[model samples]
Each structure stands twice: as structure tokens, then as C-alpha cells.
Target chain A: MNNEMKLSFSSYSSNESFARATVAAFVAQLDPTIEELSDLKTAVSEAVTNCIVHAYRDAIGMVYITASISKDRRITVKIRDKGCGIPDIAKAMEPLFSTGGEERAGLGFSVMESFTDSLRVRSKVGQGTTIIMHKKLAGRLSGFAR
Target chain B: MGVRFVLKDDHLTAILSGEIDHHAASGMREEIDRKAGQAKPKLLTLDFSQVTFMDSSGIGLIMGRYRLMQALRGSLTVLDLSQQMKRVVNLSGVGQLVPLENSRPPRKPKASAKSKPKETIPETVEQEPPQPEEESRDIYSHSEWENQEKKEVMVHE
Candidate 1:
């Protein structure tokens, strides 16, 4: 079974929870464990937060998310933003290297990378940034089978 | 999300409830800092027992508060974190700077423990056992704070 979803929301901090919740709801059909679901939500939250805080900065823009699940239970999520793109993806992805002032822990990319099986970042200066992540769910029996 | 502050003697605990994200965290941070700064407690405890969901932003909240407490010469501890929250806290290495209540081992009898001092013990060890009467009285005396918390909850809702 293969399914996918696409969502676009304003780059407001309030929408961070909405984006992650929507992705979690969409992926619920895959019968993921509680831990798996939590990992996905955290990853999605981090990505959406990056878009709201770094990508759009002071202005409000749109953040795009596309999530899909494959027959083998591998889940892929792509989050994109159309705002100020990252000047250097490598430095941005480094742990504890935040441009955001004191409040930010600078662990967003690290959290996203650890939560998901694999993470890929693509960005072009003055364009935008895209974060793509993949995680394989444990093959648990469907609810009907139990 | 809202935070309810409880002050007893020189200890302060912030009971945090609801989903904590980047959006809600800024408010919580300010509130906690304001109260902690005013109270100047020797120990600050962040109570997450009621928190339903948290993300990396939660780590930032804890880290920021830890720094605040440090600057004020007070230590901070995070208590009642769910298993999932514990995992996130551990991953961020925030546990090294701030202590987590649930992750601690059960305390041994003082008589037996006195035989050997453990070097691995964290420097910010708990100060003293809580006194129930003093806590209750403090809450009763600080009715204004309760009212403030109620207003905060209403606004968040």
C-alpha cells in the first residue's frame, strides 16, 4: 500500500504543532508504534520550526510538506519553504551551530537526523531550503488481524 | 499551554501542561524566568507531568531556564518527564547540565549511604526533603499567584 499527502501552511510559529499533527495523522495508517509516531512528530516539528524561524525570518510565508509511505513501511517526508535560503547547508546542519540567538539550542538538525533513518537537505542561496527525511516503520500486524 | 508556579521556602516548581512548541515556549520561558528571578529560589524544578507533547523546542526551554537559574546562583531540575520526553532530553545532552528527576536512582537509606561517598554524584544534588506543611502553607499564602495562574490558563484556552 502506498499513500501520500501534501500540506501548505503559513510560516507562523503557531502552525508548528498543526503541521506535525497533520503529518502524524496522515501517517497513522501505517500502524506505526508509539515511539515511531513520536519520532516522526518531533522531526516534523523541528523542520517546520526551521521554516518558520530561519526560512521566513520576520515575514510570513508558506511552508510545504509532502509525506508518503511505501508498501515496505518506509516513510518519507519532505518539508520545503519559499523564503531566504541557507547560505551553507553544511554549517546549518551542524549540531549546536545556531544562528538564532541565545534561546535556540541549535539542535534542530541534529534532532531531525537522529529521529529519522536518513535526512537530506537541499538549498540554494536566495532560493529556499528543503528537508527530506526517511524512516522505516516496524512491520506490525494491522488492527484487524489482532 | 500554561505554566503554574508553586513556591515553598526557597524552592520553586513550574508545572507545565499542554503541547510545548516554539510558539508556546517563548511565553512559558518569560513567565518562568520572571517568577524564578523574583523568587530567587535555591532550586528550580520544571514539572512536565502534565505535558502531552514536546519537541526540540522543549529542550531549548529547559536549556534557557538552566542558564537563567545558573546566573541567579540557583540550580534547575526537570521532573516527571514521560519516557518519550526523557529520550528527547537525553539526546540533546541537556541532562548533563540539568538533572532529570525520574532518571535518578532510588535513594538509599542515609545510614547505609554514609559509609561511602560517591564521586559520581552530581554537584547539584537535591538540597533537602520537601516539607509538606510548609508547601501547603506557602500555596495558601500565595493566593495571588494562584489567581495569576488561573488567568494564564484562561488566556491560553
Candidate 2:
């Protein structure tokens, strides 16, 4: 089973929910259980929120989120942002490293890493950042998202 | 963000509803801080029973309140944490700081087929359904994205 898509939206705080819902509804195609759907939604939210808060900061930008489902029932999600990228990807991924200051929990990347099967970050300081996540799901509801 | 407050002497309990994200977090932080300032509660309890979703922003909201309490010489407690909320607070390291009313974390659903990781992040940063946007989104189906040639998957074997 094969499905894929590319979406681009303004990096507005309001769009955070929009982005998560898009990926959730699309990944629902693979007929994931409620638990699986929740996992995907959380991961997407962190990535998109980062784009709105840290990446774009005070300026406006765009975020690109893509999704795909393989025959193996493995789901892949890509969240791309062309705003100011992360300087230290590893430090950013740390559980307690947040640029949002004490007012921020800095758990964005940590949550992303924990929820997804495996997380990968690629970016250059001024170029942008892309977060890729994958997970092999279990079970499938017949005649769902077909 | 549907939040109401219950003021009981030295305690102010905030009953928060809906999924909390950056957008909701901002407004909530203001509302709670203002009311806490006016009421001057010795303990601010954020009631999460009605809250179905929260992201890092939710964590930030808690941290801010904790700091506010500390400065005011008060304390903060988060009560009625759902299992999903428990997992998040556990991960964020805030579960230890905020006194959870529930002694034991909620049990997760049983794993299916292969043994998946016991740890699961709530849907999208614990993605409960995201907040609504000004533009009405169309009813989406999986087929809308069927079979696009663009495929990018990064795996670290």
C-alpha cells in the first residue's frame, strides 16, 4: 500500500493544529489504531510548533510537511522549514535544551524523538531544518483509508 | 481554551479544557497569571481532568506557573492528570516538580502484534486533535494523497 503527499503552509501558530490534523488524517489511511494515530499527531505538532516559534521566531515563514505509507505499513513524515535552522541539532534534541527560555519547556525535540521510531534532523544555520520520522505500525483495519 | 477557576481560600484551581498548544498556551498563561495575581493563592492547582491534549507549550505553561508560585511564596500542583498527561510530565521532568493527585500513572493500552515500545508520545507532541484554524479545512480522505511520486524517507540503519 502506497500513499504520499506534500503540503505547504504558513508558519503561523494557528496552523499548528492544521498541520497535525493533516498528517493524522492522512496516516489514518494505513488503518493505525488509536494509539498509533496519537503518536503521529504528537510528533507532527512538535515539529510544526518549532517552525512557528524557534525557526521563524518573530518573522513569518512557511513549513512543508510530507507523509507516505509503504506496503510494509511503515509510516514516514517529513516536516521541513526554511527558517533559521538549528545550530546544534544534538543539543536541541536533548530533553531539557530549549531556546524558549524558562518560559519554555524545551521538550519539543525530545518529544519528537521519543514519539517517533527514530528521528533525524538535517539543517544549516540560515538554510532551514528538516525532521524525518518513521515507525512500523501494527495491525490494520480492513477497508480503511483505502 | 475553555478554562474556569475555582477559588478556595489560599488555593486557586484552574480547570483547563481543549488541546493546549502555543496558541492556547499564550492566552492561558495570561489568564491564569492574572487571576492568580489577583487571588494571591498560596497554591495554584492546574486541573487537567478536562484537558484532552497538551504540547511542550503546556509544559511551559506549567513551568511559568511554578515560577510564579515560587516568587509569590506559593506552590503549584497539577491534578487529575490523564495517563497520557502523566507520560508527558514524566518525560518533561515536570512530573516530579508538580504534585500529581493520581498516585499511579494510568496504564497504557496493550501492545498489539509485535511488542512495541512501552513508551509512546501522545499524538502530535502528544498530538490531541490540534486547535482549529480560521480557514475551514475540507473533509480529507487518504486517497487525496494517493500515489504521489515524491517520496523521501531517511532511515539510520
Candidate 3:
């Protein structure tokens, strides 16, 4: 089964939940386990948060998210923002590195990496940042299968 | 998200409910800190039984509250975390800093029973020595991070 979805919303903190929920609902068709679903939701939340907090900073921008499920139950989610980009992607991905000041935990990238099977980050100094993550859902035997 | 505080003696428990993402975490952090600071309790308990969902932002919330309690000369304990939430907390190495109390049931205040001691705060606050950050594993290579696929799709509003 193949499915895909795309969403764009303002970079408001309130929309963070919206983004993750939308992705989860779309992925629900694949019949993911509760733990798998939660992991995907957390990865989505972390990526969207980076867009809202780090990418846009104080200015309001738009966050674009695209999610798709492949035939083998592989889920791919792409989150993008056209705001201030990270100069050092490697450092930003570190466990406790945060440029968002004291209130921020700087664990966003680390969480995303750990939750998702694959994580890729691309950014230009002044352009924007894009995070792509992939997670494979376990194939459960259907009760109807002979 | 909402937080309900229950204060008995010098112990304060903040029962957190709803999803704790970045959006809700900031508000919850400010509220918890303000209440904990003003009360200056000897022990601060963060009850996560009511929390339905949490992300890395929850880690920040816990770490910040731990620092606040430390400044106030108090100890912090996390209670009743869901299994999924516990995974995120453990991944951040927060369990090493704050006590993750999930094995036992939460203490309830007795109405008429006086045999049990009223004191809830533990006599000794276990302080684990901070360990050095683990070296970055070769779970994935730097070249893998460089691989990228860009797709442009239009969304109809």
C-alpha cells in the first residue's frame, strides 16, 4: 500500500501538535503498533519544534511537512522551514547543544535520531533547514491470512 | 495541558496532564517553577501518571525543574511515568540526574491513620556522580547525513 500527505502551517507553537497529529493520523492506515506510533509522533514533534523554535526564531514563518508510506510499511516524513538555518549541522545534532537559550533542552536532534530509523538534516547558513526521517513499521500477521 | 498541585507538609506534587510538547512545555515549566519556588518545599514530586504524551521537551522540563529544586535546596523526584515517556527520559540520560520513581505506587495521605510517619521527604537525597558524555557511536556515518532527497509538493488549502 502506498500513501502520502502534505501540510503547511504557520510557525506557531500551537501548530506543533497539529503537525504531529496530522502525520500520525495519516500513518494510522498502516496499522502501526502503539509503541511505533508513539515513536513516530515524538520524532515528528521534535522536528516541527526545531522549525518553530530554532528555524524561525522570533519571526513567524511557514512549516511544510510531507509524509508517505511505502509498500513495505516504511514511513518517510519530511519537515522543512524557510527560516534561519544552522551553520553547523553536526554540532546542532549533538546531545546537549542548543542555541535557543536556557529554556531549550537542545536535545531535539538527538531525540529525532534515536526515535527514527533514519535521520538526515540539510541546511544553508541563511536559507533554511530540512529534516527527513524514516521509520519502518513491523509487519503483523493478519488474523484473516490462511 | 494542565498541572494540579498538592502540597502536604514540605512535599509538593505537581500532577501533569495532557500532551507535553514544546508548545505546552514552556507554559508548564514556568508554572511548575513558579509554584515550586514560592512554596520552597523540601521535596518536589512531578507526577506523570496523568500525562498522556510527552517528547524531548519533557526532558527539558524535568532538567529545568531539577535545577530549580537544587537552587532551592530541595530534591526532585519523577513519579509514575508511562513506559513510552520513560524511554525518552532515559535516552537523554536524565535518570542519572533525577530519580525516576516508577516501580512503587505514589504515597497517599492517610485521613485517620496516625501510625505511619507523616514525613514524606527521604532523609538522604541520592546524588549520582555525573558521568562523562558517551562518545558518539558509529550508528550512522557522516556521509549518510549528507545524503538528501528534496521533493516539492503543492498543498491545497
Candidate 4:
């Protein structure tokens, strides 16, 4: 894992897009296709969003995002936030089962799952939550910019 | 985002623009239901060409509208979906419920006789998508961004 490319920010929705854009740029070195890159961005957005809405709940918190290119040219992201952790990981993973008020669909995890091949969540009540996602890039595909 | 409706004869057109996340669902339902009941148009059109982005909550909103129109013996259609928006609708199986049509001026709605019930609060507030802009974006750098097409696993744990 390359440590220099990693970045961190406060957990918020606006910053979710920023994180996505930033990670998409860093992963450009892997020469990902448009669909592949979009997948990465969407996955990252979902994970970061979950942290902001469910974990921090508008409270001030820090979200860490790290992007690394594997030997096989895969892009990996680790999004972590120190906020209210998920009490029931199983229920939280269910589609359409959101714990938010009128303004949340609880589909963040589902969207993340749809866009990426691997998604793992680890959370402890009152501690924090960490989501690790991974995606592989096509070696032959090139010409993307960072 | 709040949606406005312009009723003309038998056609009821909803002009909507904004992010359709969980937060917008309630306002959308109230406005749409109110207009649909008042106009009782034979055709319901949801213009989305102006919408920038939408998520699953948007799907639920459309579904609620579809049910409302079906009760009124009217059909619903969406117009002017961008490529990404279209993909979202398609992926969510919304296309199976209401077909997409090319953009044109609001069509004349066929007159209806049935009166729509007063707007109620049955539809509860749902989930909201992450805001388009938030602070967690500092994770990646602009210099590292690459825009290439590669076929590989998108992500892993």
C-alpha cells in the first residue's frame, strides 16, 4: 500500500464528491475505464456518505481515505471515521432498511456493493467504523490522466 | 428539491429540477399528489431532462406517482433522461413500470372525471443520498487522477 497518496477530511456529503474526485484522479495511473472509474467513485461516495449520515450524524468527525495500486493494478480504498459505530451490522447491511429519518433511503451500502467487487465493514459501538473496498484495473487500458 | 406542476386540460406536467434524495421525497409526493388530484389528467409526465442527479429515493418517488396515476386511470411517462440518469432508472427496474419518451412540449392531458383524494401523509420520509459536495473528498489528489478505460475488478475489501 502506498502511504503518500492517502488523504483525510471531515465527514460530510459535499466532501464525499471531493473524495471521489480525488481518488479517481489518483487511480488514473492504473488506466481504468470510464465504467471502472465511475464504479470506484460511486463506491467511495457511498461509504463516506454512510459515515457522515449514520456515524457522525452531522457532528464533527474525521474520515480517512487511502488509495493504493496493487501489484496487479487494482485500486483499494479504506474509509474510516471515528463516530457512533453500527450497533447491528446485519440489519444495517440490508437493502431498503435505513435507520435515518425521511431523507435517507438506506441504499448507500447497496450502491457501494453494486459498484465494487469487494466491500467489508468493521465497526464497534462508540468507537468508529472502517470500510475497505477494492477494484482491479485493466493493465492494457491506458491514457487516463490524474 | 420542490417540484412544480402545470396542469393543462387533460395533461398534467411536472417540472422538476434538483437532487432527488431521501430529503426531497416528502415534498415531491405532496406536490405531485396535490396536482394530480386537482388536474385528474389522463397522461402524467415527469420531466427529468433538467435534473442533475437522482438515486434510489427518486425511484420510490416515481413509484408513488405511478400508483397515484394508475388509480386515476392515467398513465405516467418520464422525459429527457440523461445517460447516467437513464442508467439509474433502468438499473432500478423503473423502466418496467413507466416507459421513457423523447422530449417534446407538454402534451395535452385528456380530461378525467374522477376526483383525486386530498393529499395525505401515508408516504413517510425515506432515506437521503449523500450530498453532492462534502468534505471527505480530500482523500485523493488531483495530480493522481487518471481518465483511462481498463477492464479490472472495480474494488475489493
Which stretches of candidate 1 lie above 4 Å from their native place?
Answer: A143-146, B103-157
What does the lDDT come to for candidate 4? 0.69
Lowest summed-lDDT stretch of 10 residues in model 4 chain B? B107-116
- Candidate 1 lDDT score at position A28: 76
Candidate 3 overall lDDT versus native: 0.82
Task: Write down the TM-score for model 2.
Answer: 0.80
Across residues A1-146, which tens digit of lDDT does each residue of candidate 4 receive?
Answer: 45337888986565755777799888866656555776677677667778777889969799988777765676778999899999999899887687775445566777777778788999999999999887766555332342
Give the TM-score of each candidate: 0.80, 0.80, 0.80, 0.62
Cα error of candidate 2 at position A46, Å: 0.6
- Candidate 2 chain A — worst ten consecutive residues by lDDT sum? A137-146
| Candidate 4 chain A minimal-lDDT segment of 10 residues | A137-146
Off-target runs (Cα >4 Å) in candidate 4 are A1-4, A141-146, B1-44, B50-57, B60-76, B80-87, B90-157
Over 4 Å off in model 3, which ranges? Answer: A143-146, B103-157
lDDT of 4 at B28: 80
Local accuracy of candidate 2 as per-residue lDDT tens digits, A55-121? 9998999899889988778889999999999998888888788887677788888878777899999
Lowest lDDT sum, 10 consecutive residues, model 1 chain B, at B131-140
The digit string of per-residue lDDT tens for model 3 on A2-106 reads: 578899999999998889999998987775666788999999999999999988998999999999988778999999999999998999999889987776778
RMSD of each: 13.3, 10.4, 14.3, 13.5
| Inter-residue clash pairs, candidate 3 | none
What tens-digit string does per-residue lDDT give for candidate 4 at B74-135? 99998876555555555556688898876643221111111113424343321222222322
The better candidate by lDDT, 2 or 4, is 2
